[model samples]
Target: MSDQIKFIVDSLNKEPFKKNYNLITFDSLGPMQLLQVLNDVLAEIDPKQDVDIREEMPEQTAKRMLNLLGILKYKPPGNATDMSTFRQGLVIGSKPVIYPVLHWLLQKSNELKKRAYLARFLIKLEVPSEFLQDETVADTNKQDISAMEEEKDQLMKRVERLKKRVETVQNHQRMLKIARQLRVEKEREEFLAQQKQEQKNQVSTESLYSGSQK
Candidate 1:
């Protein structure tokens, strides 16, 4: 079985005195916590193996390890796997600062091949507070989201304004068309009236000439 799966099973079994965990939320576990757990497990299974965590581990994985260290209220027993150590299983109950690193690590683990660490270390995953928020990262993401929303709003307003301008131009063209039609009708009527008047005047002059001749 995968070491990650094994860690999940081990973590789920930490009941009675610890918080009840339904599943291993690896994404929420920061790199440091992951490293510590792995170290503990590695020592148990392969204590003789000499692995340099910083060298062998990727940058993100190492960053996650450092981030998790910020949250440990009390260090787990120097050698954590010894059942006789008699210390509380948990090192810290809450860690809001490392939450983002945990989230990022979990989400990108597959892409980063974080599971490769499994070959070098063994771990027992732990559950901490669910609602812990990394203020720095959360704030950064919030600002990014807000900026994108504002940009979208501005683009929509520009589109609406352009639409209105197009409609206004169309209205002007329609008005010009109507005016041209009216002018053409008026000119036709005037031409017809002038022709009729000229015909009457010609008939009157011809009649007068005929009378004079008679």
Candidate 2:
């Protein structure tokens, strides 16, 4: 899965992360570096998540983070995979298993980042009457809501691109006679659907805020 590793490495080295990690290969990654990378990503995607995979991280802490990943509906690339297996590969930065997981995480990073922001927005989605009593606080919330709407527009454009790409890929795969490969494509289709739902949730949240504004 060199391609997967390349995508993760390229993404991590780019904006928001800019982690210029000198990695010749995934296998060359150490446990400390691996945990550091995981921590950085978790911070970006889910700021509310309290994860800190340190050099001497305990097993309980690692397992709890894995459970959080599970709650996020992360599926390892295998049938009925166990947490222990994921823990081992991830903790050691071993190849094959961890690469796919990391690839999936990076793929969802932008979407999750928005969701994390949406989560915070939802906390005060009602415009909280407490804040409404103060004109300054209400105005500040209005500004934040305006910024969120712009972000939602960008998210919609991205959703359009993903839909087009998925359509092209599905059409090409339909002609392929490989059942196994098609099954893999189906999983990606499901993931795209999940991302779409999250974006829809944000859109609906924005609508509620707009109505409250009026």
Candidate 3:
């Protein structure tokens, strides 16, 4: 049992509580309140263990220890193993800040290995409906943000494609304008050459008539 408890403690200590900053804040349990809960649980387990809960245990460690106690059916000195008494003790023994932490732990414990025992022990627990609702809202907001980011990326890609297409069209129009100017210049040159040929033909005819008359 001690080995199992030590393993559980080690596992709990290694959890990424700092990464779940929002969830921790949502629970709102202060350090001192968490310490008291840890001390109580530790005392229940072994009064002679000689470890100071406040000095040695971190908040995450305490929360995990409490979870283990609930799972292993470690009833306190005078309380029954039922959910109501357990919840009342958590609320009354600790400060108001402990409620959120307690709720969070209970919610998480339901998915743990010894969940059947925990479920039975905490069957009568009344989780705050608002907490669950707030968590859902948080999740939905994250999804919305992700979707908006995806849409923004797609819009940027489309804008880039349109820019390339517009540039291509402008290049085509410029080529056509240059072609038109060249065609007009060629037509003007052809007309001038025809006029010069006509003038030369008239001069030759006048000269030939004069020679025949002489």
Identify the candidate with maximal TM-score. Answer: 2
**166, model 1: CA deviation in Å?**
1.4
- True-structure lDDT of candidate 2: 0.65
Q: What is the lDDT of residue 122 in candidate 1?
A: 24
lDDT of 1 by residue, 14-68 (tens): 5321324333564456545544544433223334322545454343332333223
Q: TM-score-based ranking, best first?
A: 2, 1, 3
Clashing pairs in 2: none
lDDT of the candidates, in the order given: 0.43, 0.65, 0.48
Better of 1 and 2 by TM-score: 2
TM-score of 3: 0.22
What is the C-alpha local distance difference test score of candidate 3?
0.48
**TM-score for each model:** 0.24, 0.48, 0.22
Error of 2 at 19 (Å): 1.4
Range of the 10 consecutive residues with the lowest summed lDDT in candidate 2: 123-132
Q: Which stretches of candidate 2 lie over 4 Å from their true place?
A: 22-27, 49-52, 115-214
Q: Which ten residues in a row have the lowest lDDT in candidate 3?
A: 123-132
Residue 192, candidate 3: C-alpha displacement in angstroms: 0.5
Clashes of each: 5, 0, 0
